[model samples]
Target: MIVDSPKIKNLIMSYLEEKKGKPFELAVDAGCGTGRSTRTLAPYFQKVVGIDVSESQLSVARKCTSHENISYQISPAEELPLEDASVDLINAGLAAHWFNPEKFGQEAARVLKHGGCLALYCFSLVFEIEYKDKSEELTAAFNEALLILLEFHKKVVCEVKAMYQELFSAIPFKDKQRISGICEVFPLTVPEIMSFLQAICSYKEFLEQDKDKATAFLQDLEKRFLDILGESASDALGFHVYYFCLLASKS
Candidate 1:
């Protein structure tokens, strides 16, 4: 159950709304795993399609989705199973880092109507836990925990760290813009934050390499957070995460 940042979604929609000349008809959620990002498009578009390469993920997405106008399909991001000049908006939420940028760009260019928008967005994994007085210590501890898993990061991970600067260049759209330093704050408990961290791909890779070491590292991270707070481990804390978006429009 991956939950996308609502503020980021709202930001993307706002930009698209500002730039569009006509009503939004069809929106595509490329690499829409579990349909979380797909569901967000329902209210704005008459039709929304969630595309993914994994049936297993689409199965969960289907089960979770209740919007009748929203549908799911199994397809790669690079090869969208959609007609030419059909989609008004194509959004890939956090999932674009795993895609073949060149092919995906060509497909996006083919499917997007004239003046259609393609928005790719992702949040910084390196975020700080905002606690009361010990905010500095807590943030440092949390970031340090993430350092243990850096060895497992894939090459695509670097694109995210650079805030999609390279991917923005690869988007094949003549009219495009890169927006960065968009910050959003969320309230989450230490355990909830841990759950989010564990869901990251690098963490899974770290676990595969050494399960016992990974488990120990996870446990230590929680303990460190709790010690810094000097309170209940389940106590909610503020998470200040920064996000970046690359917006491209077809000419």
Candidate 2:
């Protein structure tokens, strides 16, 4: 937890002070992949349920060491098993985008006790700065690679905006809910950045699923990154701007 990496446990701890040492009666983690954040939630609540739709993912989560208060279940974010007004807080860490927001919002409202909190943390690979003082070719290549990601995800994968509205204007927090939209630039080194990408995206799957297009895209990416970043991605470290942390409440 003390690691200065972009670990979710570390981010959860950043908000620990707000927890104010108040013990939670019940808590849950939506899409708690591999229990990275599930272990963190255990200590705060009398009981914590780490839920995921994928039993395979839950299997991985269960393999991790956990506190007696911690548990895991296979369930979708849109349909949690808990009753209304049953939980003190619920966290969605870098995994909320995979949910149906209209359903998720309703379930969250259903499970949360009066004045309970709904916390989330998500980041994009868009705001990265690398290739500084590098050769022109390498720098240009890096820029092109980054741009390709934006083009593909934003232009192609148009359904990813449920969680990153950048503001709470049309969010579904209840009328009496208290919401805080947090934006922070957390600096990350190369390995940490790669791990973040692995957790949030699936470049390998994309490449495997459509080898021809993926190969072309990657070839272009390699050329651009090499041209601008001075070194191939394998050689140089990548950095990303980790920026969103939204916390809301329902009363």
Candidate 3:
């Protein structure tokens, strides 16, 4: 099991606790990739639906987390299969950006019990990183990496743009909803960093089709990592040097 961080666990739990024992027995995990976040809600809720747009990921969720109270389903954030005023909470971890907030917020409000909370949050770069000595090189690698990430986001820009327009334009459901944006710095080690780069960045896939760009990217990262630590690589990830987290909430 992955170690749960105190701050992250608290952020979610704090909101749930704020309900003051209202019994969050029914909840929804929208965009529940890999069932990681969904499983975390198990102890708090009696019936937790982990919904994702991808059937492939849902299969994995079914296999990995077979809890009796936790169920997996294939559904889009824009339209959920749940009934109105039934669920106690709806969560989107690192996934709200991919959803249409107009549809999502409206759907969320429709499905949730009045006063139900919605939590939107994302994980950011770890603070324990140490790549500052080779400041210029590291900065270049980080920025390039982010640009690549942005390019990935561009894949569904239409849905996102429409979603943002709807949410910001106050065209969503529940006039009594609340929005919150919060950020926190955390730590990550070498293996964690490498896993993140591999799983999330799709670096290997990018390399296969775009060898030249991938070559340039890795070459630059290599130079920076070596520069900061001479022959060996830097072991400590830099502290609070990144902004990889985002949050939006509605109640």
Identify the candidate with maximal TM-score.
Answer: 1
Return the lDDT, model 1, position 203: 90
Model 3 residue 236 CA deviation (Å) reads: 4.2
lDDT of 3 at 181: 29
TM-score for each predicted model, relative to the true structure: 0.95, 0.69, 0.73
> Model 3: clashing residue pairs?
127-186, 128-237, 129-236, 129-237, 129-238, 130-236, 130-237, 130-238
lDDT of 3 by residue, 115-166 (tens): 5666655443322344556545655565566556446545443334343334
Q: Residue-wise lDDT of candidate 2 within 1-251, one digit each (tens)?
A: 11222454455444443542355688799988888777777766789899998888888878784588888888898899999888887888767766766778788878887667777666533354444555344434445555555554462234333334522333366532222233344444344543443333555555556868866766655455444444444554434344355666664
The residue-by-residue lDDT of candidate 1 on 149-227, one tens digit each, is 7668857568888887767778997889877777777888888888988988889998999999888899889888888
**What is the Å distance of residue 216 in model 1 from its true position?**
1.5
lDDT of each: 0.85, 0.60, 0.62
**Relative to the unseen true structure, what is the Cα RMSD of model 1?**
1.5
The model with the greater lDDT, 1 or 3, is: 1
Off by over 4 Å in 3: 1-8, 123-128, 131-140, 155-186, 201-212, 219-223, 231-251
1 or 2, which is superior by lDDT?
1
Q: How would you order the candidates by TM-score, starting with the best?
A: 1, 3, 2
